[model samples]
Target chain A: MRYKVRELTDMQNSALKEIINIGVGNAATSLSKMIKHQISIDIPELRVEIIEKVPEAAGGADKVVSGVIMHVDGDINGYIMMLLSEDSAATICKAINEEEDTDIHTPMNQSMLEEIGHILAGSYISSLAEFLTLDVKISPPMQTFDMLGAIMDQILIEMSQNVECTLFFDTVFVLEGKQMEGILLTLFDPMGMDKLLGRIDEMT
Target chain B: MIIVGMADSAVAKKPEKLTTLGLGSCIGISLYDNRNCIGGMVHIMLPSVENARAKDNRAKFADTGIPDLVDSMVKQGAAKHHLTAKIAGGARMFSFSSNSNLNIGERNLAATKEVLDKLRIKTIADDTGDTYGRTIILDTETGQLTVKSAQKGEKRY
Candidate 1:
């Protein structure tokens, strides 16, 4: 049976949330180790949203951001993105490389930022696969720095061809007692999402 | 000024401006009739909708969107024969393995041209197929299109 995204039951939402909670937890741990500072991640928001509204979920359509894109394939197929505000990205970059003149737009900074995205986004998908007991492989991370709307436009266009809605997972990262917002978006194929919900139903 | 959202299109007459924000791999096609000072913009996400699993959103695909946009422009006093086109924002935001799906930027640009050709609309200028995202604006009075990007500041096409 096909499951309409809007018709998702509370139980199903909770189950999916639990799986993501685990994944986000794992990602936070890895981020902390990489930055050598205690990092706290709080994800109080997650939902399946229409493609047009997915960009708004991160903020406004025109907000500039730095992000990494990962493709999940194999038994399950979907896309995962880690979006950070310019300030947050710069902070993370500075923590990794303390060169006074290095900036986020520099080649050195770009590579470091991509590595940060790979480690965080990689752990996110791997943990979800473990919880679902599904064999999923993550593609190499693709890093981008541009308008928030532009980055999401690419993903939303891809998602719209496959599904009417996209799964949004958002969180906040606290570093050095400063709060920074993080958006982890997952856009699963329609059939894949239906299958995933079914698997979650069975496990529940 | 009117704002066009993703998978959407809009038309305007003289002195009015139409804009679309955040065009990454998606293509933004601007149609204008210099004789009538009428312009239209469509932000199409995919090349075609033949195998699309979702319900048909005409404005979301190049195949269906270009015709619909032209039809609307004609209804607003524009002559189809005089319509010229400018397109922007089919960008590959990432470099991945040779997956055609990830190469959506190129596909969208190609599809836009094919549709414009079928309609016989002359494409005067285009800024597309790069590794950056763009926001575009269309001025009906001047029939000029301005494309802006984070990497490349701004250019009028």
Candidate 2:
């Protein structure tokens, strides 16, 4: 038995890239407002691939700590996974809360994950909705603190054989003259791709 | 004193030993034996036996962790049928887009309940849902279990 490799067309890829660009821009705006600092986000590097290939493709990070997961449904039905180091997550949270104390042991426990999940997931979903002019509802964020392998294993279990595209962004969150780096993964269904491209075509 | 961490279990035989911690969407199981002055606890992160090979692995799934906890307790004189069970954790941590046949926390909670029922062990207390975290502690010497939640005060059983 053989399985055909599913690939996204160039037009589809470009359209999706534009959508993500808007999404990240919205996320940066939210960050800037929350931290009362100028938060800039770099253009993300996007790739479409099967779910099985995500681990190897994203295997270059030295350490992975906290993970934020959100599922978007409405013209698309796929989950988004964002990975960040503990230090980076602390920084992001500090930026959001505008805390002067940089102590990492601020009892983040689970609230940190929950709040970040809400902000980032909200930004991505809302931006996508506005750009495409569609109504979408985002569920509450769920976070997991584990190694990269464990995080990938959980994603694989939930996703089975479906092909999931991962968007890797080299996020440089600057606040108070400090910088933190993080990665974001946005997974979407093929139906989402069609709707997104359809909306883009209507605009241009 | 109460201690809750990953891959470790405690038994409280004395009433003074009050311990309970939150499980979140993770699965937590408790074991208590009155006569033998023994107790144990196990909290598993995932629901399946497949991810057992990973580094820094716990007792794997509920199926594996349940028996492992039971056997260890029995070796210390905890009778199989006499042991009482109290379980919690297994909340739907996130909503996935696929809607695939994978409800991990629910599956884990179900699997644990099934094992206890098959063994004829009575579950005296339980609090499992898609809510926040849970804290569980067992007194090894007193055979008492205490459950604590972020939203609610501590309860003893």
Candidate 3:
């Protein structure tokens, strides 16, 4: 059945938010420990947007950003993405390598960013699976620096063929109290959304 | 400047710059008539609308969108035969993309070319098939197409 975003009850929405909040909080904690620095996150904001609007909703289409994306498979199918500004990527690299002139474009730096994304996603997905009682695994990470809209358009296109709405959420993070900030986004297909809502219903 | 979003299209005359931003695995086709100084741009995600369940947005597919753009420009006083096409922004984005995500950029570009060929529209320029994203802008006054990328330097055709 095609699930419309407006049809979701407030109870389901809040429950989904609470689950996402816990998952993001756990991921944030993992990153903070890895960097050995404090990490603060904005409230996790969720949305159900048409596939085409996803790029604009995440940020401006043309805005350049560093992105690491991975597909989530198994019981649920979707994508998990990490988007960081150039400065944010630099800072994250600096925190780990503790070196000067952290060029985020270098192959080494790129993989480093991918690893960071993987670890955070691992933590987040684990918590989500544990909470929702669902089985999901993330694919290998793909990292690139490009316009935010371009980076995500391909994924959105892949999603659009089967689903009308993309269920996604964004959580902004600031690391070590610096201006370094990044966003973590999760996008799910309609079937996945239905499965998630079904699991939510069963748990309740 | 009129910004065309993904699965969107726009038609404008001279003095109005038409642009579509951040395209990946999608084709941004710009049609222009130098004599009339009129331009049209479409950001198409899919190659054809034939197989899509939702056909309301003709701008979302290359086959439907390019014709719609041409018709719009022609209606606004531009001659259909005088229209020339410049295209950009069909990139793999991720080199390792596999399975259902395979070479969609190339597919979109190929579909666009097929449609343009059928429409007898000459494609003067194309910057595509790389593993990067591009934003394209069309100058209605001069019919100049500029393709920009974050990693690659800018190019105009």
Candidate 4:
């Protein structure tokens, strides 16, 4: 049965939020370890919105962001995006590549960002998998620097074919001393909502 | 100037531009009439609207959006015979998906081209089917379409 995103009950919303909160915590911990600094993440926000409103979650439709895109499959399939402002990306890259490693060049910045993205995503998805008892596999990260709306258009086009609305888990993170902020977004497959809800119920 | 959102379409006249941002796998189809200096752009999400559980959004699918865009341009003083088209976007962002159903970028572009042909709109230029995303702007004044991307910089057609 097809489920309307807007119809999610308060209890369902709370459950999903809690689940995502755990995932975000794990991601933050992994990031902190990699950067060798304290990282703090804001309370994750969960919402069900039309595709157009998604860009607003990251800032605006025209907001330029450094994005790392990946697809999650196996039990519950969907798209996961790690979006960072150009400044935040630069900050993270600088922190990670602090040593005067001559090997790191201009184009290597992108590779460094992708590596960080992969580490964070791996932690987040693995947390979700362990918590939900679902085996989820993630595709390799594809990096892009562009307007958030355009990056989203890639995933939302395929989604719009089946579901009119999408569910997103949005989290903001700040590197404690640096105060650099980034947003991590998870656009859950609308078709997988039923399966996800069922799994949630099983947990409770 | 008019800004088309996801699954939306807009029309404009001379000196006005139509813009849409972040066109990953979605197709941004623009129809311009040089004679009248009128233009219309549609951000179509799906290949076809037929069998869609939700038929209310005509601009959300190629089959319906292309015809509707043509009709709107004709109504707004654009000469049907003078209309030409340019399109951009339709990128396959995820490379690891083995599922053919995930090849929506190629499907969307093919379906858009087919619909444009059926409507007799001559496709003048297009930048589609790549791993990168694009933001497109259509100039009604000159019928010049600008495609901007972070990886490839910008191009005008």
Highest TM-score, which number? 3
Decreasing DockQ order of the candidates: 3, 1, 4, 2
Q: TM-score for every candidate vs. truth?
A: 0.93, 0.53, 0.96, 0.90
Find the candidate with the highest lDDT and give its number: 3
lDDT of 2 by residue, A60-172 (tens): 21134576777666666666667776787777666666776555434564566566666877897888888788877665666765444335444543443333334433444
Q: Each predicted complex: what DockQ? A: 0.67, 0.05, 0.79, 0.55
- The residue-by-residue lDDT of candidate 3 on A1-204, one tens digit each, is 545665888878888988888888898899888878888776777788888888888888898999999889877888889999888888888888888867888899999899888988888888998898889988899888999999988888888787777667777787767655577888777778888888887877
- lDDT tens digits, residue span B22-136, model 2: 3545567887887776777776655656544342334545667778778887887788888888887676545555555457767778888887887788898887775445566
Model 1 agreement with the true structure over B31-133: per-residue lDDT tens digits: 9999989999999988887877764689988999999999999998999999999999888887657344778888889999999999999999989987888
The per-model lDDT (C-alpha) reads 0.83, 0.62, 0.87, 0.81
Error of 4 at A91 (Å): 0.5
lDDT per residue (tens digit) for residues A55-159 in model 1: 777786767888888887876777778888888888777766764544788887777777877887788878988788777788888777898888877667766
TM-score for candidate 2 (chain B): 0.80
Tens-place lDDT per residue, model 4, B37-92, is 99999988889988676778899899999899999999999989999999998887
Worst 10 residues of 1 chain A by lDDT: A94-103
| Poorest 10 consecutive residues by lDDT, candidate 3 chain B | B94-103
Tell me each candidate's RMSD, in Å, in order.
Answer: 1.9, 9.5, 1.4, 2.6
Query: Which candidate ranks first by DockQ, i.e. highest?
Result: 3
What is the full ranking by lDDT, best candidate first?
3, 1, 4, 2
Q: Residue by residue across A1-204, what tens digits does model 4's lDDT show?
A: 455678877877898888888888888898898888788777877877787567766687667788888888888778788888887887677667774433322678887778778888888889988988888888888887877887777676656656777887666677766666577877677656777777887777
Instruction: List clashing residue pairs in candidate 3.
Output: none
As for DockQ, the candidate ahead, 2 or 4, is 4
